[model samples]
Target: MSSAFDDFELKGHKLDNRFVVAPMTRTSADSKGKPTELMGDYYARFAEGGWPLIISEGVYTDRQASQGYVNQPGITDAPQTDAWKQVVERVHKHGAKFIMQLMHAGAQFQHNEYTDTPIAPSEVKPKGEPLALYGESDGWKPPKAMDESDFDAVMQGFVGSVNRAEEAGFDGVELHAANGYLLNEFLSEHFNQRGDQWGGDIGHRLKFVAMVAKACKDAAKGENFIVGIRLGQITVTDPDYQWPEGEDAMIKIVKALKEAGIDYIHTTDTDVSRKPFKGGSNKTLAEIVQEFSDIPLIVNGGIDESNYEHIAAHYPNALLALGKKALANPDMPKRLKDGETIEDLEFAMLQPTATLENEWQWRDEHDKHIEAD
Candidate 1:
């Protein structure tokens, strides 16, 4: 049996505990796509709070259509890559490993500096309107169908970003293939309607993601450089969507990712324990992954102080990645270990927009209001 406080190892990186800070999009970077000083502090806060591993928010990989929101961080140019060094340095000082999550917006796009159009496996729009938390948009725009050149560019973007991540001194890179982003758009049958080899069946749909993963692994400058991916059937806005192929499809997807040299798999959903298989399977997505592969597992979604112990007991070998709970308490690991009362996350902290500066300002005002009473 494994507890959350126990040390764990993923690839060659030895984690201090099974607790991880999940990647969250704060949309808190400079207008030029450089990581700001504030962003460094925002990430370092988690490491200082006792999280062993911190996965950064989705970072655009290319200057062409990869950016999904205004002020989103990018890793395309030298200066942007150089700016990330400070962020990595800050986290490393706390003895925590940081992994940059590389993403392409696809049709879920709200804004992009390089191009007005989003690119995807097909010219499909996302099922729901763009998220108000990230950016404002009436609805999702239909993406341009990707061609051979587009495919090459997407691959190059991921590989180049992985190299930049190495240059920035990151421990690893997680391909943002979940949450209906570009890679995930390819995975979703609703978004990926292409009749070509890149679409149709589970294997074909997974081909692009596999190729990107292999390219990232091959491009890693260090043998110990970790390359992982976040996978989910549901997007941020569209929750009801599941694979038409269901549990078997998920099994094959896990098998394919393992074959593609993915170092680990992070399964996220609205709830990690939910049986979302439309075919009526009793297993959760994380369980399916555990049953199929021996790779390191990081499970996310609705993992909070109340249910963490039970969740940990079930996925004994897996790392529990916390998003909302971590936002509520950056020092969750320390607090949990100390048996301190952890506060719940209030939506007011992210009111109007989700940004590091905004959160700080909100806290100041909130604390002041409390004192005034």
Candidate 2:
């Protein structure tokens, strides 16, 4: 009998299972943006622990301009590419596939790092002030309005990252168009006020994103490469905000992504299980996405043992991506396979290193002692 554990094909590869490690930022790389030994070991454990596919943390594609936080990895240069090779090799050794998430933080990043002002679809400030956890709060500023020249450069940067990811041995790439980053900024009405070809209605707003997706897809042609995109309902900067045109715009965006040849659409939002606010369908967000696209929709956020079964039932090809839960337990799927209950973890336990609470706390005290000595 076929089970939920049965293999499913995604982007030319038969994924070993529907369980995926959702992309989460770990700001632990060097300033120059090289992945550390710890980073490789960190990801390989999830693969070794049995996840079929892993979406890596958001990796900046435009070197300086795209960086959102300090110590996060970059994919714009040879060193960054070379560093990722170690990660790919380790994941492949465990029989799991890896995909790099290409991102540009846009106005949500540091202005000091780039010296030049950060570029966005339009000049607008983010909704809230930045957080200290991201290393610098002042990084969140109104971005300079992007011109035709900046658009050309940004497009090339995304396409370059895809080429570099393939060269670095990754099986695929996912564009981070969600979470109020550059792409998400364009999708929001409060941010993108441009009246040009790149902005206006739902379709026009998605034009630049489509360009990047198509360029990356074209670059990966004939290669054993998978190209996908991630979408979000609300911006990280403004949770209360809705899309400029609401559900219709969202439905249109999904269709546009599918037409651009994206193999899958990974959605990060309020919750996959939440009911529609003002839609004709009584179905949840996951069902709505499935309704709009023929491809797989990776539903994330608020997915745990409690609701995963019900949420997964909405889409025939839904991939359940675990974020905080995955950080706490690499063997999440194994537990599910054995029918074990998921843990309720403290937020402090899932960052920097997802180790035991006492161990992490002890290490901090030890470091202070060493400093005094």
Candidate 3:
């Protein structure tokens, strides 16, 4: 069985180990959606701590309805792209590969600079309240159903973001199709009630995402640039919801993504071991991906040092992506390798908000040693 710490290669990029810093939302960018120097330091710390790959926070893809939070960073303009270049430099200085996660919040939006309204595949709203940790929106509002022009704009936003990521010196980009975002909304039956090519059945629902994947791949054609996606059945606010087609739907989704030239598939769930789909499938979602596709896989959810070895043994070739644990211990891989105690994440660190500045202040007050540059 392969160890989680074993060196691996994702696409053509050589990874130091199979541990990746999963994409996390840190609404700490400047009001103009430009990444700040603090954000650069925040990311570089993880790489210096020893994670091989880092998938960035959900970056807004367009100026329309994509801005999900008050200060969420975006990549629609040159200044934003230039700001990310500094972040990329910081990560590379620590010898880590960085992939920007492009996102368009569908209906889970709390605030947007350009528009007051949100947009989705259908006019539906998300099931639960806005995350208290992300923002202070009272409740979700009904969204405008995407039209033909909206579809074209969404496509261009993603394509343009990928091109900007390439120019900004990022290793690649991961389409944020998970966590109830625009692409995930398109995949979801709850949010996609359209009768057109963008929605209807499972096949139609997969069309837009597949098209986006192909467009991203086309934009990032050479230079060992990687294009991947994150997918899950559960939304941030609605965890109990399941796809109508269950395991069969997930299998079909994986097949479609592979055919669309997605270099990797990152699956997140409540746990890596749980069979989350309906109809009582024996296989976990990660297992289904391994069975259906030959590309690289990144598995997240409830992974820690205690069970990571076992999880690694199960998915021998897959990378182990961690969020909560990584937050508590940025040097998680090195800590595990050296038999050091890995810190557990206290909700206090992210209490007021999930921003970089808040985390730093919490660490200071709690005497948590943050490494200096």
What's the C-alpha lDDT at position 108 in model 2?
A: 80
lDDT of 2 at 208: 83
Name the best candidate (by TM-score): 3
Question: For residues 80-131, could you state the per-residue lDDT of candidate 1 as single tens digits?
Answer: 9999999999999989999999999888899888898889889888876788
Clashing pairs in 2: none
In candidate 2, what are the lDDT values of residues 1-373, reduced to their tens digit?
A: 3334768788678877788999978776777888887677778878877789999998988754788777778898999899999888988898889999998988887533454567788888787777554555544566799987888788888988998999999999999988888988888777789999888987888888887888889988445689988887567767666665667877888778778888888887677766543444455556667787787778888777777766666566878888878866666787788877766545654343433333246446545111100
Off by over 4 Å in 1: 368-373
User: What TM-score do all the candidates reach, one by one?
Assistant: 0.97, 0.90, 0.98
What's the lDDT of the predicted structure labeled candidate 1? 0.89
On the 0 to 100 scale, the lDDT of residue 192 in model 3 is 94
State each model's CA lDDT, in order: 0.89, 0.77, 0.91
Off by over 4 Å in 2: 1-3, 276-283, 350-373
Best by lDDT: 3
Task: Quote the lDDT for 309 in model 2.
Answer: 66
Name the Cα RMSD for model 2.
Answer: 4.4
**Candidate 1 local Cα displacement, residue 115, angstroms:** 0.6
Angstrom error of the Cα, residue 145, model 3: value is 0.3
